[model samples]
Target chain A: MALDGRIEQAVVAALALSKGADAPPRLQAALDHAVFPGGARIRPTILLSVATACGDDRPGLADASAAALELIHCASLVHDDLPCFDDADTRRGKASVHRAFGEPLAVLAGDSLIVLAFEVLAQAAGDHPRRAVDLMRILAQRTGMPGGICAGQGWESEAVIDLAAYHRAKTGALFIAATQMGAVAAGQDAEPWEELGARIGSAFQVADDLKDALLTPEEMGKPAGQDAAHQRPSAVAEMGVAGAVSHLKDILGGAIASIPSCPGEAKLAAMVRAYAEKMTPVHLSPVRG
Target chain B: MALDGRIEQAVVAALALSKGADAPPRLQAALDHAVFPGGARIRPTILLSVATACGDDRPGLADASAAALELIHCASLVHDDLPCFDDADTRRGKASVHRAFGEPLAVLAGDSLIVLAFEVLAQAAGDHPRRAVDLMRILAQRTGMPGGICAGQGWESEAVIDLAAYHRAKTGALFIAATQMGAVAAGQDAEPWEELGARIGSAFQVADDLKDALLTPEEMGKPAGQDAAHQRPSAVAEMGVAGAVSHLKDILGGAIASIPSCPGEAKLAAMVRAYAEKMTPVHLSPVRG
Candidate 1:
């Protein structure tokens, strides 16, 4: 199936899970806000891709992992937009949660998403408690402290930061989780898949940094130049725009090459290569102009 | 084993699971902030108590459940103190997360706790995948949208509010979750336990409102009148302190009476009675002065 099909299936599953005879209207609204006109759904796409590479018998698990990842992403976005963090007024070309529903609800919404992510994963992986536990650990690690996205957010408050650590967490962590989770869902070995994910995630983050340097706010939805404005270190800051572009290419190349020889390797490899190629020079070109 | 002993064991187990090999310094600090001098580990206690009541040999599950519940509570507190929500400067008589660490680290720490809660629960209940799923679902519902704590936060934003709904969410939801989760951990049917927990949680919220109305800032360890200041509807506002006190007794009575006949019935029943009596007006006179 195409990435869009897989994402739609994941979104549908997520929406279906949110339903209950006792579900409150506010909760329904919050769930809707979480998934409607969703962001890239890149995590799920990667997860599905890896799962497909492994085998096709695990579509349900793939969808569940995708939904869980999106829930985490949505939670982070809700928290990130709070006044304490980015204070973003808009997301996905619309008012951010704090802006739309107010701060209190926004916080709650984020909290709910975090809880729901685990719920979805647990329910979806009922027979695979070990995998679920492992997946939960991976997701939690990426979401929180020291080497997680939350830590990445913390780096912004400091006087100085290690850019590599920041990139790895702020972007790479979830992507790493996606592939690892996907591989686990498919009953494949997790470590090699995690490495592939890390590379892809790192490349993706760099591409994002390049876009932030080169794109207009209209193109990217949120404000551009935030990295430079905040003096948040980035590949673009360290390597310059052209150098960053070249680096993204190298990272993407490595990511594509890392996909192991397997039964569905051709399709999976093609998807990775296509995604990276399209993400790198082509996306960067528009932003630079 | 005694409740305190169980708590210690659970904490040790949870801490051992922390990432970063030696347990990251920041996470260690957070664990202390979360566990030690912790506000009642009532949820986990109830879970163990319920499990004991159910004749389950697995007190380990309950202990882990308690630790996980505490983590969730800690996570919520960290988020609650952010610049956007209560914006409180202190928690548990000490500096709130944002005040102690920077806002960013505080956010990350909170997120970590939320993630850790799920991870612990997943591992703790590894032997019972169905129970783990149930626990996750129950936790998600209590913490997630509409009726969950998150939805409760969202309700604060609207121009109009339902006072009962607000109280149910802000305080009661987690309490309900705790009882239900404890019941599940004990491998018992959830209905009776849920009823007991709901009543207790409702009464607990009323008590919290009473605390807000009656306690001095020194006694409460936080600003006492902020709810009224924010014009947020509270039990004290709707019922008056004395009326709220009466309601607490009624709710506690209901909760105690709802406990199923079981091995631990006498002890659990006694504890509930004592807690309710202590909270009631007749018994509260001594503490009032």
Candidate 2:
């Protein structure tokens, strides 16, 4: 499927899975509101691409993996916007979940999304129990641990931290899970794909940092530069903005190079190049303007 | 195996599994601290009893199941104590995790425990993939729903709330999961044990409410009366203290009645009755000269 088609399919499926039975009407509405008008499905797209490259015969399983990872990403965003975290009033050019619903519901909503990610994986990993279990492990590690996204958030409170560890766990972990899960779904037993995922995942995090430091909220469709407010470390913190950009290109190159051993490496490389070009500092200006 | 002996063995094993290869020193230390000096292993005790009553031949499986539920409960307590939530300074008469380890590491510690709960279950249910999967579903629902404990906290912000649904989802869900997991681990079919679990689960929630409202922090080893501070509804809210006491008896009776259909029903009932009595208002009073 085309990247946009994959993104659309994943988003719809993810939103559908989060609805609760006899749940507070506001919780369901808030989940839909946070998911709609859509945030970028960059992670899921990468997942789908990697799965396809790995010879996945089951498109539905691939879609489910993609959707599951995206739900986790979406959940982190909801929590990241809470008053105690980024304290942002808006997301995607609209009211943040906490602002739209109350803080209490928003917290629960974010948490529910996190749980729903696992639920989606459990229900969706049909005939791939082992892969599903592996996916759960990878996702859980990213969502919870030292270098995981939760740890990434926790790092904000520290006076000092390893910048590389922060970005890798906070942002890169989910991306890695996405790529790994996609490959696992495709029944590929290859090792190179994991390294490819880590490299690409890091590249994506660097790209996100570049956008946060350089792009407008309008361009990103989410608050920008809020990382500085919490005194959290970013690539832009360690490296100058221009230096971060160069580093991002290098990361992308490494990610692409790691993929050649897999089948259809060129197509995956092309996808990386196109996405990188579209998301770089130069491209962000027109969207902001 | 005796219930107390089973609990001791399970606690040791569960804590041992907390280690990770790439775990940060601070995160690891925080985890150790959070789980050690364990509380009354009440939920697990109840779970093991229920499992034994249900014809579970292996006591080891019951221990594992109980440990998983306790880990979940402990993890939730850690998160709930964060500045974003209760902002408590103490738990079990010691420094709360965020107070001890700082906010970031504390958060990661809690997140780790939550993931660890599932990991424990997944590892234990190695041969019974279906039962293991079902355990994940049950815990996931209890920990992350409209009526889940997390959602129960969210209900504090609503203008009106459903006491029964909130209590059932929050406290009752884990208890239910514990019973069901124990039974499943012991090879009981889903249908009968689920009903037995529901009864015991309701009683557990009522016991928790009794402790929360009527007991002092020194007596309970956690902060008391925070429920009123948050304006959240409780069994105390829907029914008077006397009514809550009566409700506990009724729920316990139902739980015991459901047990006669299973093996070792009398012993299980006796243990449950003893536990419920120990948790009663008079039993929880602060000591006096």
Best by lDDT: 1
Fraction of true inter-chain Cα contacts (below 8 Å) kept per model?
0.45, 0.29
Per-residue C-alpha lDDT of model 1 across residues B117-139, encoded as one tens digit per residue? 77777677657766776777677
Candidate 1 lDDT over residue span A181-279, tens digit each:
888788787788877889988888888888888888998898889888877778888888888888888888788788876688888878888787768
User: Which whole-number lDDT from 0 to 100 does residue B153 have in model 1?
Assistant: 64
**Model 2 regions more than 4 Å off:** A1-11, A14-17, A226-242, A260-264, A281-289, B1-21, B54-64, B83-85, B102-107, B123-125, B208-244, B281-289
- Top candidate on TM-score is 1
Model 1, position B89: C-alpha lDDT score: 84
| Clash-forming residue pairs, model 2 | A147-A169
* Cα shift from native, residue B253, model 2 (Å): 1.4
Compose the digit string of candidate 2's lDDT tens values, residues B72-139.
78877887787766788988779999899886566557667776776666566555566566666667
CAPRI class of candidate 1? acceptable
